[model samples]
Target chain A: MPSLKNIAADLPPVQKTRRVFDGSFMVLLVLTLAGGVAVGVVSGWARVGQILIETFEFIAMLAPKIGAGIFIAATLPILLPRERVGRLIGRESGVRGLVVAAACGAALPGGPMMTFPLAAGLGVAGADLGAMVAFISGWSLLGLNRTLIWEFSFLPSDLVWTRYLLSLPMPVLLGLAARAVMQRRLA
Target chain B: MNILIGTVLIGSGAIWLWWQLPNDAWRSASYRASLDTFLFTAPRVIVALLGAGFFAELLPEDEVRQLLGAEAGIAGILLAIALGPLTPGGAFVSFAIGAAALKAGASPVAAIAYVTSWSLFSTTKIFAYELSFMGRQATLTRILVSLPVPFVIAAMASLTG
Candidate 1:
């Protein structure tokens, strides 16, 4: 199993001041301002007012779901420690390991800031590239938290389901493919 | 309707998990973590949602449809896949853009392609996190292996319909 606590401890310190207003947030702000100003200029002030009102209304509706998503992201790590998760996915091999890792990835909630670090820890935890790929791909394709709070809220339910079902088998397949490629290189 | 159901399901699951924590210390630690996460996440979420709103309005729907709508066919799907990585911001931005495009007449298959591609190849995540953590080769390997996924998913989605 991986000594994940050590790996996590080794990660570069995240500056609190830089957390929210960093490059990603700057990009978001710049784009939003550009879009808002563009719409105001081209579509008129009245249209801008209407869009802002609609945005607020939508936010009100989404508050509960958003709150729940936040809680899940917070509580999941405390409930399921990285060491335990590492022990589970680590030292395990083959198709079963990939499946387990994929499931863990899907179940784990958080953004890339959290997910990537945890994944890096999985390296020390004994997970091979296949398991690691399975984990990352699973989160990418089927993150429960994102799908619940974001995807279903935005897309039509049927469209979401169709895409979801279609994508469901993918992480495992990618894991298998990664394994094949690695094995080929080794041979 | 979907939002309500999802909220309830996720909320209850979270509560249940909290209830299952071994003791008061763990519960307190979890709560502390939640607060910290809320501090870190809430601003991002609010800003992202607002940004998504502005973007939805600014998107030239008619133009987007011309580029990625039903009549646009395979080419539209390909274009959407291409655009996924180019999109700036987080998941909300992409999903909001996807929703706007759908409303603006983009195909469902195209939306799937867009979301899948964004998940895999978003340059922000790639450069900032993956490359730094996983190194260049592993990152490239994942990208190379994952490259066909969105296109294949879009094709399969179309077939299923």
Candidate 2:
């Protein structure tokens, strides 16, 4: 078993207040509110109420998984610190780097909020552009948690499997392509 | 059934991670971080889901069927790919919309194309997160290299199914 990297204990505790209502959240809120109003106008206020009620019921059903996901997202970063992951990934080149980068991206359980920062940090830690692209692509296409928690819930099992299998090679292929493009520019 | 399986797997993983925390201080800090994340994520999930539900209700089923059904073929796949980047919000929003579209008689190929396209090129993800973090040059490179993925996946999927 990998020793739980206890390095988080050594760092000074952060006291930053994370705002719940940022520009992204506001965008989503406005879109939802607008959609709700449209439903009221086109269908009826009763339909809007029913939709709201149903959405809440769906949320209730999803709460446990969401809680678990949030925990993994928060704790994983601490346990597997960015510097360590960057060191592990940054030194590699060619296919090996792409594979490692993709593996990290797929295995890491978090949303974009966590991933983009990690990718940026990886770059600063000496990862090449190709590896970074692979990392982001891997997370976008094959993130285990998102597939398990959300995709399986929404899409049919066969469809999900097909997509997953097809996507298994994408990150590496994209990484190679990114490298090729970068080389072409230099040439 | 899917939800149950997912919840159990993720729940166990969460427990294992919690057990791995070294001591009381680390555990407490982890707890605080998780709570903060939950606070940030929950509202977005709620709003995104609500928007998905409302938008699903508004979908013109007849037009969807005409455009994306089995007979619609390559054109439908192209249309689905085109619509992917335009979708706003998070993963759930795209998945929910995909589900609703499938219910409305869209073909499986179109749905796969749509989901794949959105995953790679969603404007929301690009504009809000990727650009700010990854820088414009890297972001453009990723997007450029990934531009053909959905089409390739869709093509292969159609061949098999």
Candidate 3:
């Protein structure tokens, strides 16, 4: 297996510049408009306007938090750097490896486009299935960026905290579970 | 109150990261990147928030309560988990719907399960990205191992609550 640094270094830094108006945006636009129209038809235009006002007010409330979240998400990659994180996870093994992998997954910023590729590369970088599973699970369950920026913004804080705290140990447990199953197959 | 707490927490975090920028070049790059992200994110948030609001208004409280309320029990959580992967769009869509469901009387446990399920198994993330990047075997293995997560989390949350 290729070394983690070698594998990560081989992959070019993926600068995925998201289009402001993409397929997802178009879908959201249509859904929002359709929902608004339905509300108007079902209740009244007044209710639709009310919803619009409420949305904007919520946006205003969220602006500061969103601003902070964006800064953290953007700056995190620069601070941590890919090669260092890869090296850290790649060099370790057993539970320590899984812990490092989970930590990296949670701290690493970006969406699925960035994460999945990195995960695939880690697998090639000599990381085991346990580490790989832990990494993905951590990103999915405890990604700080998603939780702080999106989850907190949309969901109630109590619910967010409850879910987050509950999920804290899951990645490692899942990693161990994956390892056990794979080992059984080998045995 | 929640927003205030979140703002303070994230605000301090941002400030700390800014302090860690190390030099002028990095600061500029961070600013440019943040601006780009803001441009990318703002419109989506606005639209998704609107959709969420409208959908919240449209959700029949009676049905939501019947389907996913505290009274709905384990079946409600199962339904929530099932709805997660089927929901189209991104993080905001699932979160918005989850919030809407909560307003319409869905149990907190069900909401947690829905969000957890969506985070782990979003079809767009899976079929579009994970399957292509991680290949079928890795993806399938990950899915199989993770199949019980939402249910498990929901049960844990219920127990704690």
Candidate 4:
């Protein structure tokens, strides 16, 4: 129900081609290739083949969730814009603000590239340090997309559940701590 | 079981969010963004997952057990935390490595610490994204406040198990 504010039209257009094949991406590719080669050399080509085959299988299994995650990440901002986000969690929003910010962070999908900008935008729109901290902490600790799609896939169900449950309260606590720290500084 | 639940929940969320778009223009924008995100994310996921698989095979299982096994205690948690920020690549890379360590006899507490620390302070994310967007002071504040989280989470996790 929030609309975007401070849309920076002067911001340069994203270079789509460069984005997909940047230096980091190249490094990642090289590392994977090198790792595969080293493993093949040390463990045998058969093991490398098996691993590559398994990797494709895992990719196939993951395709649907990844698709869903992409959709949410794209569509979410439309529903919850900076103005609405800032209004609800502005600097003086207190405990309720922290809770809302944390929940938004947990529910908001995407990686750091997506999150950090949103946090900056929200800050300009009026979110305070506490809310900002809560939002980032929530995303880092309990992002639904990351936890459900990736974490569950790799870790055991019980361990994932244990960690997830214990972490549920952390973002708000951190937000509160950040607020208190800021207050002390001001006082 | 976890996969099924996750797929169902996320699927529903995506569908509902899709239906909520206000108009044709909004729908078009959303689609465009989704496509771009897919372009950016897919390759990274594929390459990172593959890298994780290869690295999993190479990990020294005996050494891991000696360092992070149940008997390793608090030291293992600290070591795991230290490794989290230093790891390169995406979330899957860290999670996959954590899983590999778990399979190689790493304690659950240690794994918890590793994942949490990575989530909070992955050096790559901090340097490449956070510092650039949020600026130095805010980033530093967030980091300082978050310093204790992984340790506390690991401690709580250890208590129940």
Give me the iRMSD of candidate 1, please: 4.5
Off by over 4 Å in 1: A1-18
For candidate 3, the per-residue lDDT at A21 reads 95
User: Candidate 4, clashing residue pairs?
Assistant: none
Better of 3 and 4 by DockQ: 4
Candidates in descending DockQ order: 2, 4, 3, 1
TM-score of chain B of each: 0.95, 0.94, 0.93, 0.94
For model 3, state the Cα shift of residue B3 in Å.
1.3
DockQ per model, Cα: 0.53, 0.72, 0.57, 0.59
Model 2 — TM-score against the truth? 0.95
List of clashing residue pairs for candidate 1: A2-A125
lDDT assessment of candidate 4 = 0.85
**Docking quality band of candidate 2, CAPRI definitions:** medium
TM-scores for all candidates: the values are 0.93, 0.95, 0.91, 0.91
lDDT score for residue A17 of model 2: 45
lDDT of 1 at B122: 92
Cα lDDT tens digits for candidate 2, A30-143? 988899999999999999999999989988998899899989988887777777788888988879999999998998987787789889998778888899999999999999
Candidate achieving higher DockQ, 2 or 4: 2
Tens-place lDDT digits, model 4, residues B70-128: 98988888999999999888888899999989999999989989999999999999999
Query: What does the lDDT read for residue B15 in candidate 2?
Result: 96
- The digit string of per-residue lDDT tens for model 2 on B9-92 reads 999999998988877777887888898888888888988999989988988999999999888989999999999999887889
Q: What local lDDT score does residue B111 receive in model 2, on the 0 to 100 scale?
A: 97
